[model samples]
Target: MLNREFIFSNPEVLKWIDNKFIFVAGDDWYRRRAQDDASVWFKSIARKARRGKNGSTQQGCYAVTPKGELLRFINTSDPKKFTVTMLEALKLWDGVVQDKKVTIPEMKNFDYKVNVPPIDPSKDVLIKVQSRALTEKDGKLERWNSNGKAGGKPAVGHLWIKQAEWQSIVQNFKTMEVGETTPLTKRLIHRIAKFHLIDNTRGEGPAWESKDLKHAKVTLTRVKNGFAIRGMFLLTNQKKSLSHSTELSGEITINQSTARPVSWTMIAYGKHRGEGKYTRNARPGAQPLGFTFEFLPASKIRPIDLVPPQHMRWQRGYWEAEKH
Candidate 1:
């Protein structure tokens, strides 16, 4: 299912000089893994990215770690920021030499939504508490005095939704690419070291055995509140088993296959912000954010989405010969 030209096309990206190893992986690897994940060679690279420090470069096509490792690369949502930082880094790294390495910078925007849990309904209390402060004269709050003390002034307090309407929320995903210049954070480095990339290819001959497998690229998506994220994935084989789920603490209310009729979920993580909501709290922290949708038949989802690719391109190929 993989072609040779596709595998070794990006020579610059495929070749690297590091203190330890040299490897090349990018579009070819991503495509191959995306296509037939059972291909033996696909598994090798898959293991490499998952088991090694190698990750994608800023451009999102492909990149190598300083230690000489292959990784899936991506760019941040803000293209300008990525370009500026990369250029600056290149200038710094080049020093006297005018020639600078063209690198893609990783981009990730963190947005946080504060959630207020719903209050229980049933409660009994005496109506002894009486105050003339908040009573409206003409359906409006009464004016207050300048003394700061309440003189028929309005009583301001927390507002609660007596009844809430269920609105369809859209789950947005932000992609970030990693590169040589990309600063390695302690948490990210740790994830790369402990992460496990798996290849999910449908097996032939015996239904249970893998026929021809290829590595697959799985990324993390940060979504807060109760909004559900959806995507159109290429299911090459109709028989291929597909399942969707989160890998973190939040709950998965609805996991649907078809897009025609979307699904909905109540009681989720964070708090819901109206339409086109945006926050600055979503980030990688104590709870690794991501969702694992194992192409394999039997799999479960965690709370967060997998980290999105920093900068990557869609290609139609695989990386097999390199391993063989």
Candidate 2:
């Protein structure tokens, strides 16, 4: 998150990268093992990093030639350090020559399931979800600090609502009274509680199991603008070691004539405890963990926005979360 907000977001850094590199971003999970040209090329460069071929995580920046000769690799999030490494890599490239005789291999056995986006931007609703860890300091909530340093930046993920599900919601709204409230489907509620409302502020958090969602309920109250969303959820692992008890509140604006949602906003604020295997170094006890969901316009979608949800690797599990 810091890397995106600081390094990649810097105009000067972006100019250098845009002018000199064919920057490609990928998910490490599939790239490490997939049988494809892209994955093969990624492995060739990644194996030279400090993590090497055996480390559990080979996540870092790499500068390589078309022939897969690694020039430099660094894992620091510091923009200055990263920029220096980029400079050094460029200097090394100046002394090297490309091997035109080497031909790129055909991608025959690549994994297609891992490469597809979860939702169609033009047809489905995409909600941008951001989660962050917070702490109470002097009676006010602030970004959590780890060992006196700034806490990790907000984690981002997208929530997908199928067109069918969205249309069902609109139809339901049309039949409701002005102030009547209706509970959302268990499937939708569970999906949000299990996958979207996770504490991924520090790293990749695990999805909540069906049994972990002890209580989940979200209702929509018909209103003048659209509908009012209110709910609460409680999730806990079998051992009760990891938990998130949160209250949700938000509003949705709809196009009355078309019965389509024009704006959707939701916030989940609560105390979270424990951590996942990858997401460690959590506070000793419960702490504030908040997630905000906002409707993202299709026109505003960018290349980064096309990245699948963290848990979307298991497409069935993500879509039918309640059944799972």
Candidate 3:
């Protein structure tokens, strides 16, 4: 059971009497309230509440069709800004819903600031992954010590990945300091990324997590084309059977123009012990991996056909048959 009447209806909601929408709790979304359906045409917005800047959460408003295609959202939920905000939503709904082109408010600079690179999808991004022992020259392998060294040019741990349309892409990968080529399970790559593509496009939306983190501090700022949101939190608990826990810090570079992540990176450090396959040769403590995501335009993505260099071998992990 949760609070259902948390959202108050005002005169602004009256005009969209025919539209259908759900009013959910800002703190907990599972609680739902009824909507007013006094009109004939069902046009509404798919609104949800998210943690806003300054360590507060607010319910965002949206204008959408019956099928739940979003037209626009009201960014601010401040009482003082209600009148002006609703006025704007009204004009957008009237114009777009009515299918008559209407002039809308031009997006301007935000109230906060952060350092973010200006992104232009017009240019193709060259996505590359640097490796330590994956490249060799004349039967000699270039290796990176525990102190940190990037191997060679050909061992450029790059992948012929597919194009995607989401912010966060998390998938399990089996990697090690194997031969000259760190081959990945191509099928798993396709399976994981493709799964998110469908889930992201649907109304499921990004994981709206609010608990399980402590001493969390976040600084959010709107950048040129989107937002640069960085946050840090402490995790002191781990599952009983698990021998590792981590203090996590992550940054999400969101393309506000599209509400998709332009780049997302997470750094974990604290205590860790390898489990499963790594148990036989797993080291304890201080294994920090710089997991980064760089999204590229779908049109620029090419087919992946990885081939090992001369005298180098490829090691395919769990995604494929245990082929050496």
lDDT tens per residue, model 1, 2-120: 11222334344234222222343333333333323222234344455553224332123234333223334334434444344444534444453432334433423211111122222
Scored against the true structure, residue 103 in model 2 reaches a CA lDDT of: 74
The TM-scores, one per candidate, come to: 0.16, 0.84, 0.25
Higher-ranked by TM-score: 1 or 2: 2
Total clashing pairs in model 1:
65
Residue-pair clashes per prediction, in order, are 65, 0, 3
Which candidate achieves the best TM-score against the true structure?
2
For candidate 2, give the lDDT.
Answer: 0.82
Choose 1 or 2, whichever is better by lDDT.
2
Candidate 1 lDDT score relative to the true structure: 0.23
Residues 173-284 of candidate 3 have per-residue lDDT tens digits of 1121212122123342322221111111112212111221233443333333333434333322233222323333344454545544466443323332232321232233
Residue 152, candidate 1: Cα error in Å is 59
Runs with alpha carbons beyond 4 Å of true place in candidate 3: 1-220, 233-271, 277-279, 305-324
Worst 10 residues of 2 by lDDT: 144-153
The residue ranges of model 1 lying beyond 4 angstroms of the native Cα positions read 1-74, 93-324
Candidate topping lDDT: 2
Question: Local distance difference test, per candidate?
Answer: 0.23, 0.82, 0.30
